[model samples]
Target: MIGATGFIGLNVVDALQARGVSVRATWRKKSITVFAQKRNPEWCLAELDDTVALEEAMRGCDVVFFAGGHYPRYSLDRRASIERGRADVRAVCTAAMHADVPRVVYTSSIGTLDGSVAGPVNADDRTVDPPRESVYRATKWAMEEEVDFALARGLDVVTVLPGACLGPWDVRLGTTGVLVALLNGALPWWVDGIVNVADVRDVAAVHVAAAEVAPRGARYAFGGVTTTMRALFEDLARRWGVRFPPEELDVAAAYIRADVEEAAAAPRRGRVPMPRELVDLVAWGRRVDSSRAALELGVVARDRETTLEDARQWLERMGHVPRRAEATAVRSRNSAESTRGASAHAGSRKR
Candidate 1:
């Protein structure tokens, strides 16, 4: 596995290990602590774009899983980082093929898949026609094409596209990690988006199964249940014994427009305001179907409630709630400021 130290990658390593499969997972220098000191200690240090190290990692392996990618959730140095993401995909797939790995499974995003239509989105549903919401989609799409290039070269390859994966073990993930941020009050308000989530474990299971069952050049959708922003927050609040208001927060359009304007206005690597595209993504979260994974790969998605409960418990264990205290301080300050303003208005009226 290329990204064995990340949230999804670590979960995958554990799931694969539980199935009695020996894994040699790779990570960068910073993530070494998470895996090197662990009980198994089969973690190797390597960068994704490092062809020599990557080839060494894949040598003699029966299957290669490319699960490494950057999250484009914020305003990044789009011109540089986006190209780097696309290039990494190409390099990894090309290296895997050169290493003679018999089977390759590439992890992609449902963001590249179309969700404009109402109702459940199946693996067979046509991908979005054009104009993806952000560079993430564009890069994932390009990487999927790279997979196709490998398949054309007579490599056994399949792509697994998962949507907004969430479950336990999001300690280091990008998107699902957002749950920790929200619970810790790093996020003041939940964006307006419905999310189609798959359990991290289930996504890993499907990846392993696809090594054998999924047909060459096929793409499988690997998502489970769908929940609105309010539903997700309330679930977390209940789990944490906190109060969450059920007020409707419809800021999707504003966020989308703001993201565009921010992206347009901000300098590279500077603080870019949250993009509206993400807000819209949260608000219009689409439903995804995993029937193909269930029937073909023998993978079944866990219940949505179970996924959330597991995430809440796992996050608490990881010491992510300290930020919740920070959020409380901010709220108290705002309230005090409001009170002072009210008192000043009353004094002026008496005068």
Candidate 2:
């Protein structure tokens, strides 16, 4: 596994490990120490920018799983974000082809596909044309082109387009992290939008199965339930017994566009607005299909209930919810209040 320490990558590593596979994971040079602490002891150091090191990491590997792609944060400068993504695709593909890895499972995203599909069962959907949502989508599609070139050269490769992956082992990054934050009461209100989502473990399972069973040139969609922003947050809140802001802010796209532009002008500490050209993203909605993935790769998604329950369990385990602690604090406060009232009454009688 190339990116064994990332949000999705960590889940992939854990799933693979549980199945008795010893992962020879790799991370960027600077990430080696932190990744090493959490990953298998056999983890290797490879800089994505260093072609030679990347090639060495792929050596002797039967299948190379490229989960190393980074999604640009909303804060990145536009041009630099595009360049970084292009560089990643160039570097990783160049190294993999050179190392002659028999098969490479490249993790792309549902963003690369047209979001106009009617629902999650639209198995006939194809790729979208130019002028997309985010720089991340553009770069991911660009990487897909590299994989196409590799396929033309008779290299065995399969690509997976995963929807928003959410589950445990999240280091609190990615889109899933945003959901986590909302569940933890950080987000003020539900941003009105719809997204297809799947558990990280389910996505990882598809990747591993694709690596083992999928044929060359197969592209699979790894999406689970289709949901609106409102529905997802509501479900999560109910599961966790937490209260979320149900009040949807009535901001139109024009309002957001103007504000985002103003914000972009000032460029805060590490935050960047979505590209002004792509501000229509929140208004865009579509379902994805993973039937192909199911039929071909035998990937079965845990039902929506299971996924939500698992997410709640994960939050509890991570101490994101101090349920018992909150209860104890409330009891302590009540006790103190009772004692104060009794003492005040006794003093009044003495007076």
Candidate 3:
């Protein structure tokens, strides 16, 4: 399993282990600390561009899970980003092919799918042609093209594209970072948008299932629920006993704010509070149909409420949030305030 130290890859490792499968997990120098523990499976340290080392890592492993990819959160180096993204997948595929790995489950992002159409996007839907300026999307599209080439060369590969995955073991806090910031009151407002939510556990399950049973060269899109950003924030606020901004920011306002933040932080060598890509995503929301994964792979998605509750619990367990008792106290106080405000309004009307 490449990228075994990543947020999704770690969960995939856990899933495979639970099923009693021996996993050959790979990690880079920076991630070795996280995976070098006594309990981890066999480990291999190799850079994404080093095909020789990766080939050594793939030896004797029947199934390879290529969960490796880079998503820069702050850097604006377009050329560097695209090269790194393409190289990561190419290295994995080349090494897998050389090592004669029988099957591979590659993890791709939902960003590669086109969401501009009217209906929920499925695997069959065309992918968006990301503009020249959007390095991340363009890179992913390029990676898919690479996958197609590998398939033509007779590599057994099944691709899995995951939507916004949330749940336990988000050590990097990639997808769920917004929830953390909102709960911490650092980001008080959100842009108007819709997002498809999926549990990381479910995503890992899908990857394992796809590796075992999915047809060669097939792609499966995984999405749990489609909901507005406001609704998601409200749900988090209610469950975490916090307050979110009542008004949602429009696209123009969000873009302007992002620009200002980026410009100001550029001098300090710091990242913008909100990125332009995020604002654009909010303007163009995503809605995908993942029924193929359900019907073919037998992936049963957990309900939104259950997923959120599990996220809250995991956050607390990971020391990202206050204790359960403290959270309950906060909820009680907010409930009392609401009651008092209601009574005061009723008294004013009577008077």
**lDDT for each candidate structure:** 0.68, 0.69, 0.78
- Put down candidate 1 lDDT per residue, 49-96, tens digits, no spaces: 788788888888888877876555553354565677677877777777
Looking at candidate 2, what is the lDDT of residue 289?
A: 74
Q: What RMSD does each model have against the real structure?
A: 5.0, 5.0, 4.5
Worst 10 residues of 1 by lDDT: 269-278
lDDT ranking, best first: 3, 2, 1
TM-score (all chains, Cα) for each model: 0.80, 0.81, 0.87
Give the poorly placed runs of model 2, Cα more than 4 Å off: 32-41, 117-124, 246-282, 319-351
Residue-wise C-alpha lDDT for candidate 2, range 1-351, written one tens digit per residue: 777777677777777878888778887755534643565547677888888988898888888888887565542355666667668767877888899988988888776666655645343366645335455666666677777787897778888888777777665345545545555566544446666778888999888999999988888987787777678767766665556764565436433653454366545523222232222333444577788888988887788887766765666676765454674576679789999999999999999
Measured with C-alpha atoms, the lDDT of residue 156 in candidate 3 is 95
- Give the candidate number with the greatest lDDT: 3
Tell me the tens digit of each residue's lDDT in model 3 across 109-224. Answer: 77677766788888767554554545556677678878888899989999998887888777766666666666666674568787878899999999999988899988999977
